[model samples]
Target: MEHINQVIEQLNLEASLTLEEIPQIDLYMDQVIQLFENKFTESKRNEDDKVLTKTMINNYAKGKLIFPIQNKKYSKEHLILMSLIYQLKGALSINDIKATLTGMNQKIIKEEIDLDSFYTSYLNLTRQNVEDFKVDLEDSVKDVNEEITGDKKGDSPYLKQVLMISSLVHMSNLYRRVAEKLVDEITVEKEEKRHK
Candidate 1:
């Protein structure tokens, strides 16, 4: 129970930078890398894991996952996009991310929306989702405990941990599947329109 509480607490502390936390000035590539590294160090899975890298940034530019840099400096918009890409990479394919971001850039180019407006909306939803997730996790723990109450092994910490991990993985897989389907639909719609 203590371990479970600690996990929940850590989840609540998951790092995400607000718009105000990002540097307002354009940053050189090295500066951009350093900023992400410093901000997301705690989010890394291992001590050796890098939060961002120059090669990764360059590849994002080449793949059109991000807007082009100007005078070798990344603007705030670029940083926001990169941050989004970093977060989405675990749950989305690179091609899907490219398609989504490209569509967004087209909208901004056409004056349909501004970057800050979109990012603000995203941030709002992210914060709300995290809170919702924490509640859901607590509820899941209770449910799992009840389900295993009659079994001889029910009191085993290992059993609780296993069940919780299984439940969480199942839920995440469902969400990922739904997101992938939506991305596929978006890609197909774009292709069909281009052919018309």
Candidate 2:
């Protein structure tokens, strides 16, 4: 129960970097990797787990997930795109991510919105989503405890932990499925526009 509280606390503290926090100057691969590694240290599951690597960056470029670099240095826009990719890759396939980005880019252009403006709006939405998620998570834990309390098996601390983990995993799965559906819709929309 104590550990669960800690997990909730950590999630509440999770935040994406603001645009001002990013360097204005272009960054070489090593510097970019180091920046993400340092900033996302808390996100690592293990001591040796890397938040970002040169290989990943190269792959992203090769896959066209990001724009081409200039003179072997990545610009601020590249950093923002990479940050978005990093977040999306947790639940989306590479192809899905590519399509999603394409659709978003098209929409942004149509709306005459710059990347910085779009990202700022996205950050605000994310903050609100996180707050909503926190409330939902608290409710979920409370519900699980109530159900467990009525069952004889609830006496086992391990059972409580298992139930908690199961609930979280199911919630994550639900979100993932919804995201995939939205990506599919984006792909369809792009195809329709192209054919028109």
Candidate 3:
């Protein structure tokens, strides 16, 4: 188990494994299964999401998930993006998250996501717009009704406060899938052009 962990230590997400190392995945997976069996603890899945989120933020900020190995090295950039998928917390499988995050990292590599301008713009808008939306929604609701309704009230602007975050999460997932195909197309085109 220690050997398996050592081999993975500091290896980037896209790190190449030798032919000799290829067959060891089965052995490592067996260890994983044994570890899971020995330490079975039941908790809400969302708790894992919280743990993932905290781990990702810390790792990304610090630029690595696990500590450096003696010689082996993993990609810090790769794991920073992995943090986002960690919050997803296995609602999606490890393979699924890896595929999705890989595409996102490619997008970042290609300048599809402009880090400084994008987050700065988003944060500024989110800060002001969130309060505006909430205040306006409350005032509108108070003007219209003095009491609570039994219905879902899904139509209200107030619903945006509760649902928009989840809706964005869903939309982000949808867009990531769509974007992955585009990445495939771009990769193919680049390969074809290179051969010519």
Candidate 4:
């Protein structure tokens, strides 16, 4: 249970992380259900929506939880986004989130994604990398900053996400590189034989 929330916050399905490319969203939604199973799908009785509202939301919206004119209740999606807002805090901007969502929507429309598989394993793996990357990411960011002045400030959310999967992708490609080198060598040797 403790590790569940840890997976959500630590998991990095960076913006470039297309659903088509990855297995799942770190199984976040499933973790949420498991975390509060008694409160949600498994509960014998229903609970009021009011309990979902919290003072923290006001702070997240910069101290303004405007009661919507279209009935004053919050849905799970809103709560989830708000929770992200809180987690991301100063690291990401509202505009960034909007753009990300818009991009995600476009991907869904463009590429009929089948979002059925559980990504808990990927999520847990990502979470582990994020922890491991703390110092490495900071150092790399610093070096990158030194290279470019006024570089849109701290922790490029873009890079943060890239560092994780790119590392894995590159690692996977290492074998490809070796295979390619072997093939090149074989071709060269065969060509030499033909020439002789």
What TM-score, over all chains together, does every model reach?
0.93, 0.91, 0.29, 0.27
- Judge candidate 3 against the unseen true structure and give its global Cα lDDT, from 0 to 1: 0.41
> What residue runs in model 2 are displaced by over 4 Å at the alpha carbon?
10-13, 104-112
Tens digit per residue, CA lDDT, model 1, 7-95: 76654346776799889999999998998898888777678999899899999989988867889999888898898998899899999
Write one digit per residue (lDDT tens) for candidate 4, span 62-155. 4232122123344333333443343333343444444333332344346444322223344455567656655454555455445343455534
Q: Regarding TM-score, does 2 or 4 come out ahead? A: 2
Name the regions of candidate 1 deviating beyond 4 angstroms: 11-14
Worst window of 10 by summed lDDT in candidate 4: 63-72
Query: Which number leads on TM-score?
Result: 1
Candidate 2 lDDT, tens digit per residue, 75-104?
A: 888898888998899899999999888655
What is candidate 3's lDDT per residue for 27-103, written digit by digit as tens? 23233223322322222233342332333434433543222322232233333343344433335444444444554
Off by over 4 Å in 3: 1-103, 111-113, 140-144, 147-196
Local distance difference test scores for all models? 0.85, 0.82, 0.41, 0.40
- Winner by lDDT: 1
Question: lDDT score of model 4?
Answer: 0.40
Candidate 2 TM-score over all chains jointly: 0.91
